[model samples]
Target chain A: MRRVSLLAMVVVAAPVFAGAVADLPSGRFAPLYGLDVGQTSFPVRAFRLDVRPVSRADFAAFLSEVPRWRQGAVPPALADARYLATFAASKNPAAPVTEVSYFAARAYCSWRHGRLPTTLEWEYAAAADETRRDASQDGDFVQRILDWYGQPAREGDLDGPGSPRNVYGVEALHGLVWEWTEDFNALFVTGDNRQDGDISKRFLCGAGATGSARREDYAAFMRYAMRSSLEARSVLPRLGFRCAYDDVGRSP
Target chain B: MRQLAFALCLVSLSAAAQGEPRSVLALETRWRTESGEQVSLSARKGRWYALSFVYTSCAGTCPLTTQKLKRLDATLAKAGKPLDVVVVSLDPEHDTPEAVKAYRARHQLTSAKRWSILVGEQEQLRTLTMLLDFKYSKNPESGVIMHDNAVFLVSPSGEVKATMSSLDGPLDEFVAAVPAPTKGS
Candidate 1:
């Protein structure tokens, strides 16, 4: 076993506990809000995210039974076919697939009778407060993340900060695999500037430009820059996604 | 003298045959270093370079990876085989040249020529990352960027020699895995 010491200077502040909410109804969307100065919101819908990322063992089970997973039949540009997580080899059967692609993730979602969350829906759920408004502002995202990072991450069990907590009554939102959304290309802006366009083309108006306005005014820009770094096809080691369902009550 | 010459020839031939340099498509993108000078991948190909993806605001594995790279750099220097260490920012939005400079200073990476930090346009970085098979994504709501953690070793001839995962490997193993610079190259 290789012993590696991390020089990360993180100060895990005492765990701040919030009041527990009622259990969210199945197939309903919930909001996971951030802690910042102004309004920042991500609306997360309620669906079971595989507790862990797709593991090697989970994938291997699929490989043995599913013909599509075999070598030469698997999708293009997938990482090494042999490496699996050590923890996954001994874990439960229903754990989340960790190192899978957007396509693979979609396949799994399809298999489970669920769909990937739309980008808007995903963001709305992720940024929503306890009441689904911007309790935390855009400017404070980095600090909140830093605060989260400072805390000791709970492992193994699925119900923690990233998992559906008993307190907030929502499922995995942060610190999990960067979840995939359905409408990954939708752009958002407030006031007169609100319009939808090609997210890639709007890079200039998006994040990376600096000003007080950039900080306070251009919330959409920040979101766009953040999402633009991702390739729709690639699956990162840290990237994992959850599934969402349409509101049947509203649709009918 | 004839035997010694024959042995030397055999060694050279084996070294040439054992090293298979894979051609990597290097993109030309301008990045400002801590010193405020513009730099690009094309300019650094003649020397062995170890490149890692990082953002200054990252509180998770980036710091660990940087510390490991710094250790590798120190080890290489002690072994008299120093190489260039380059950190390319995955989050160009927050990781400006000034911010990168502050990050370097925080980690005490002041040695000028051996280490260089860079930040550039997101598109160019995306292109470079694609070519290198590096994957990353950012949460639109929180601005948290998640990326694959791997250090890529590029040869002096602009070829990708090897890649090492940051989570579960010895730095010494990765250091030893790096192919030594060819003599008189």
Candidate 2:
């Protein structure tokens, strides 16, 4: 019985060490942006993604290990004036961390031997509902996402229930917070996005509903527009991140 | 430079640990030069320089940027405030040493000793570009890289002093931003 108990302990311990990742299958992804004039779907390779957004507790542990990332110690180039502002608000171990800049989030992932997901990978994993993969076509799933987007910002639901686990076993992709991607700033917006919107050739796609590959995927376009507007160092109260791993069998 | 001023969008950056302006020198990523040697930018510290991104095979815009840079170099030299030009390759997968040599010959840049062309891994390229707000993305299918045409004037400490568009923006303001050469070198 003691030997059996020891074997069970090892079984539970292995996944915890791996930080709970899910292996998403390879697919042809059609992101809302980045496709050129005739470019169709992007061939997305299979990759591992964190099961949930990086939690406040996870980041706190990282900060403890690497003090340079502590609230006041981070360099100005790596984070903004409000970087990690929510670290102290809630110590809930499972809540998504917020207010981390792209650079800082990238660093945390690097320290863990992983990196932030590409925009395509993130969107691909997020397209699923609880029961089915590729549910972006489902009107109910689309409306539910829009409804979450329309809701008022939660003050600080450190321990609130996350988005239910999807078919891929990933959780809290939505109804949680916006995330940092590996190349969030690669977007080319029409007009001077940094300035007043005007006529400019740099406008990547067209504009409004017309700019998107799938007009029905308005929620994805909103996410793209929001991503385009951000600077690498701009950290917001709702912006957090998760890490994606390259090696599937190896623990992160 | 109306377009340039709009594109740069240089935001307020607080001083670094050295109490200096936010500097790109803090990045530790090393790059491979035209000689195929990997090196850090630290060797070029303590001297103001101009940096831009390009690909040897880029048929559009990059050539324009290079010509503008050559013109800018001559203008600075004539003004006695000459600065080195650091050009990073956008496509390392194809910008091999031979391609770099061909590029130098095609652009007539072989005699342009002040210019340094460097290339490295895509990850490093992305990191450096992000820090400088030098946007670029390579199309996987066509191997075409769509990038911004901005050129940055960096300080001795690696902080960006000013920027200008190489495609159409004027150059007088960018030239004036470079500090005059210190007395007696």
Q: List the residue pairs that clash in candidate 2.
A: A190-A203
Error of 1 at A73 (Å): 26
Question: Candidate 1, residues A18-88: lDDT per residue as tens digits?
Answer: 11222223333222212222534333444333323343333444444454644445433332332123323
Q: Among these predicted structures, which one has the highest TM-score?
A: 2
Candidate 2, residues A119-194: lDDT per residue as tens digits?
Answer: 9899999998888878887888877777766665666654565578898888888878889899876765431232
Per-residue lDDT of model 2, residues B1-185, tens digit only: 23222322221122111222345775666898778787877777888899998898888678988998989998899988888999999999999999998999998998888889999888888788877766776766788777777788888877888878766767899999999987987
Q: Estimate the lDDT of model 1.
A: 0.51
DockQ of each: 0.02, 0.21
The docking quality of candidate 1, as DockQ, is 0.02
Q: Give the TM-score of candidate 2.
A: 0.86
